[model samples]
Target: MPRIRKNPTGVDPQLLVKDAAKLMPAPTRRLFLRGGASLGALAFLTGCDIVDSASAEHVLMKISYFNDRAQAWLFNPNKLAPTYPDSAVRRPFPFNAYYPEEDAPEVDKEDYKLEVGGMVDNKKSWTLDELYALPQETQITRLICVEGWSAIGKWTGTPLREFLRRVGADTRAKYVWFRCAEGYSTSIDMPTALHPQTQMTFKFDGEILPRKYGFPMKVRMPTKLGFKNPKHVMEMAVTDKYLGGYWEDQGYNWFSGI
Candidate 1:
């Protein structure tokens, strides 16, 4: 008779599965669960032994990368996130950031210049007036956060695809990266960047974007989780390199889509 292999590290296999599952998106988690949560299966998937906590964590990280790929493959650029009417717009949209509202970076509109670089024909830096002069559009969309809360707000800005075209960006590039004045940075896939709804937002609710909401500009991607929407953007680059984001480096899934 074959003997069962007991966990040598005393860490409950079920607990390890639970921890890893928590980091996955709902649909992926359900699929994972349906596939079976056995430690042997996880070991097979990660190609590592589940003999210790460290190995267990490595397995989880591998699963996270798997989740990222799965979500990216399943994403549909043509599918638009739902939009709301003016009456549904949340009054006093809640302020959110890693820092306090008072600490939001105060950018001077006159001196601010958005530096553009990487895989583009036009590498020129753009001033506030130049950006604002571009044709703009508005959409009332919900900002869904990973922290379990959501808010609908009106955002007005230039479609990122049009802006990319105007800048002579290589549409075939793999990623579009953004750097913010507040030391926050993130990158998104080219497909999402070219999505019609993804905009370089300059105004919120028919007024200049408040300092609390990223004064000069913000990238409003209703298709992604709130944190994926970078605020106080100062620089942008089109690249094939995989430059990880602040949260993404901390183990959050890179291809986080709603």
Candidate 2:
């Protein structure tokens, strides 16, 4: 069984701020701390001037939002994550989720139908065969987990942008949200959704995606953390509404970009 990862918020506020600060590059970290953006300084920005748990949490969240914005601004939809040769791909990629491995959802492919809704010209549902018949693309990319480990895996699937275009999705929409078979849901910004490397993957390691790795389909996002790449995706929608993710609602950073 995979070890249960603790909630990021279980730590004290000062420690949380310091940990978040580490995510910044060394030079940026130095500048951020020197600019009075440290935890001691953040207490003043929250208008509380007190380091109470509630106020500290709020200040840390604001800084997280600033980090998200910075990452989004630096993201390049055209540039791709570095790919590895097949020989360099990780063997037996690690499995991760909020639950144990034995509890992974069992999808019924025979009866599976991908529901497409929201801002689109055609809200037609799709079958596994229909999705497979769409133009297929393949790439070898690393799946970087928030837990500080990463694995290189080859994936085969349709370009999400092409699939969205076929379904007449509103490309101008602000967000693309997905519902998974295992009750997991998440959303991504429009630009990231259309990124060249963002694929609606059906195969892993050159074979049909096993149930352990999101059978039926998964959104393989190399540019984002593993949790941001949801699995067993069953439904999708294009909308401007902000749908907080399962972890996001629990105070995990919403825009957890790589």
Candidate 3:
């Protein structure tokens, strides 16, 4: 038989609550603590026992949902993530993904086609040349990762909202999901997908995006954590259904706001 921990720790409940609150974002944590709810009370509210892994996961899931709702309520679509000066742009912006940099998928520039579908009037696939011809803009923004590091980079791309508009997307949809060439996928709430800063990046640092940094294309979302920004995207769909992301399904929060 496996031993089960009766208490999360030997620490007092109040102290545990205080320490656990650090896991939450600053704003959400403040709001959560405003009612001065006890740790036991909170656990009960989640309908989970703290006795085992399954019950503990249930509690954590509830907390994640609470955090998600809090962030959704606080999010302002019009508010943009901070932009940095060109001089502050990090040279050789770090390459990050579930796979090693050398293992990044090699997209054939001549054969790549972005398949767009779901809740859109135009479901036509687009080539890199076609996408490049769309109105382009540039922004220097910081990419905040869940791993506790960030880098500023200049990304050149078509505003995602504009592309969606041209495609006659249902802007009122609940979510937008992307599937990448490298077997990674993620989703964003509609508000974040349509945010002015959301971009379909094709270039980095005044050149074609290198393979290590997502060769054919990437969906860059400054408002979201790094993992939310999928790279080497091959397909996209706008939907009202809950399409969980790779990380989200594995316990990361679905609405992973920065």
Most lDDT-accurate candidate = 1
TM-score of each: 0.80, 0.80, 0.81
lDDT of each: 0.84, 0.80, 0.82
- Candidate 1: tens digits of C-alpha lDDT, residues 48-161: 755345555577779988998888898898999998889999989999776556656778787889999999999999999999999999999999988778999999999999
Q: After superposition, how far is residue 5 of candidate 1 from its true place, in Å?
A: 59
Candidate 2 lDDT at 97 equals: 71
lDDT by residue (1-258, candidate 3, tens digit) is: 111222122334454344334445434432333334465687687786443345556777899989988998888999999998999999978877654455567888888899998999999999999999999999999999887889999999999999999999999999999988756789999999999999999999999989888878999999999989998898999999988887787678889887
Tens-digit lDDT string for candidate 2 (1-258):
112223222334443344334444434432323334466567667765555455556787789888878988998888889998999788888777755555567778877888999999999889899999988888999898887888999999998999999999989998999988767899998989999899999999889999889888999889999889988888999999989787676566888888
Clashes of each: 0, 0, 0
Better of 2 and 3 by lDDT: 3
lDDT of 3 at 187: 91
**Which residue pairs come into collision in candidate 2?**
none
